[model samples]
Target: MEKLQLQLFLNIIGIGSASGLLFKENSLFLISDNSTYLYEYQIEKASLEKHALVENPAENILKKDKLDFESIALKGNNVIILGSGSTKKRNQRISYDLKTKKIENKDFSVVYERFKKEASLSDDELNIEGLIITADKSYFFQRGNAGNSANGIFILNADDSLVFKKIILPKINDVEATFTDAILVDTTIYFLAAVENTASTYLDGEILGSFLGRIKVENFELENTILISKINKFEGITLFKESDKEIEFLLCEDNDTEELKSEIYKLTINQ
Candidate 1:
């Protein structure tokens, strides 16, 4: 496989970790950590720029004093944000509508609750990190860290029903694999996974490195997993298509030196 070079786009500090990204109707939305605010960017002249910032209305309804926004998914004008706490309890999923700016808690809690019961596991074990809505309105989620296994993926039907479950095991390697972000383009699924030492005594076995992977949707099998760049800390992954024969990837890195001062890189695939 040929290694692709990553191009830097924009670096904003203290903006928060970009957990999720979506492009719809010519608008781009990025979800972060500190606040449930969706940063909007416009695609103009083959580039992106700040368009607006909208607060997630569902946050206002949360009775809990503190909440950490983990992942987000967009449906029509509604946005779903999932989060977990330090207590290791069941995570919370909140929904906010962009049209009315209304908040709805427990929008799809019943589905998740049923899945939890069927799996016979507590909420903490789910560790949902990435969420994606299909063309038919079905929901798919990726598990975060702290799970018993490295593979974590689930599906929620259009009726808000739990349909399938599968653990996406990583390719055998010396490093540990943890999925970070995912995006679906046409029939292809592209995801980012961070590979690191599973036994880091200094950082308590936390992931310290990352790689980008691509797979076809037909079989849901990994095609190629490549180490794109040596980043300080990687958070989110987004795809940009240049043309039929050309494509690029945008990866976000979280570095402490600059709060939101993250790095965005453009990458190409070897055909």
Candidate 2:
């Protein structure tokens, strides 16, 4: 694939750090890494609505106490949000029922522990940034931004077991790129990756660049990589629309701040 054509699609301000994105029907569902609320944006009306994930909604959750929801995926009528699992506090998985507008929370500590054991990852090295669910399996992407850890994809089987695969991602501008988010399109996995200078998951670093890449779901082999932006740290991506000639993707940026301003971009790829 050649360089992707990028455009400034939406400049959403006063929202938390946008980490996960999903689109269904006419609404855009987004989740922040530090907030306990899900944002629902109407495409036609350009209006934003906030639904509290917890009974009590707060504008911001402290970093130490935040659930750190990092990825969102759709399963039937449910929108599932997953935490990064870099810390014990970030081990909560949530499912939002679209039909009934109900919230269900699950403790993901056991699965996260399985990930660490299977991948040989330490506590500080495990950061799950992406999730993709199929009819019988779930793929959890582990970001390799932390200390000496390699990026990985953990496949969860129907038997409540995990099969881990270490991934080797290409470097961007001489900086190491790690997984951010991904969505499965047909048999291809389209993913977003970003480069940061920090070696610790808890610390923020300089955002060198971000890119869009593809991997074959059957063999887990990389196929293509395209530069999206050199400045924005995109942490989430979803299909906005598609046709025979072009595929449009919606990307949400994460600046790692409490300033309540974030940007989402539209990327067009010509087939």
Candidate 3:
């Protein structure tokens, strides 16, 4: 595996900490964990436009304590934003209408606990930080993590039910690795995982390194693994095809203590 380099795109301010990214139509959206609004990236002007999470997000969509929106997905004009399952906030999700610019309140809290039990995880271990819609649009893949075989994917059926799919990742240097974010290209599922220096809870771990793995949808097997980069903390991943075997990625990171600044990196993964 060849080491990939992250090119600095631009320094974004007021993001606090970016957790999810999505490219839909001609616009790109980056979600924040500390706020209820999304940073919409304007590719043509190379600028950002802030869009509020929902109508009166202050009262309905986000919590009064913290907004941990960690995943973003799109279907037509509807944009899905998911909360990281670190606490009770895991069940907070939204389907915002782009055309109407309004939020559709949908509760997953009822299923979050059941979803955790299915993954054989408790509330603290239910680290669902990534999400992607399936190819047939029948279900959504909810990425979960912990260690050993505890980390896997969850199927969010259209009827709002859940299914847990187990994934076994070979330990890196005898240390366990956990799942983060995921994206699907055709029938292949590309999931990003990291092995941290310490076993932190579902909140945020100190990332020593990260890996990109490919799993076939037919068998749900991890057929390959590739070392990507050594960023301290990798939170989200979104990709675009460049060539036959190469895909460009925009990896988001959070360094809380360092000047309170954060970055979004552009890189390419050659499969």
Q: Which candidate gets the maximum TM-score versus the true structure?
A: 2
- Candidate with top lDDT is 2
Which RMSD values do the candidates have, in order?
5.1, 1.2, 3.5
Clashes of each: 7, 0, 0
User: lDDT at 149 for candidate 1?
Assistant: 35
Compute each candidate's TM-score over C-alphas. 0.73, 0.97, 0.84
Question: Candidate 1 at residue 170, lDDT?
Answer: 55
lDDT of 1 by residue, 178-217 (tens): 6666767677767777655543211224345667777676
Candidate 2 overall lDDT versus native: 0.88
Task: Give me candidate 2's TM-score against the actual structure.
Answer: 0.97
Task: Give the poorly placed runs of model 2, Cα more than 4 Å off.
Answer: none
Q: Which ranking of candidates, highest TM-score first?
A: 2, 3, 1
Q: Give the per-residue lDDT digits (tens) of candidate 3, residues 145-184.
A: 4442267777767666667787876566666666767777
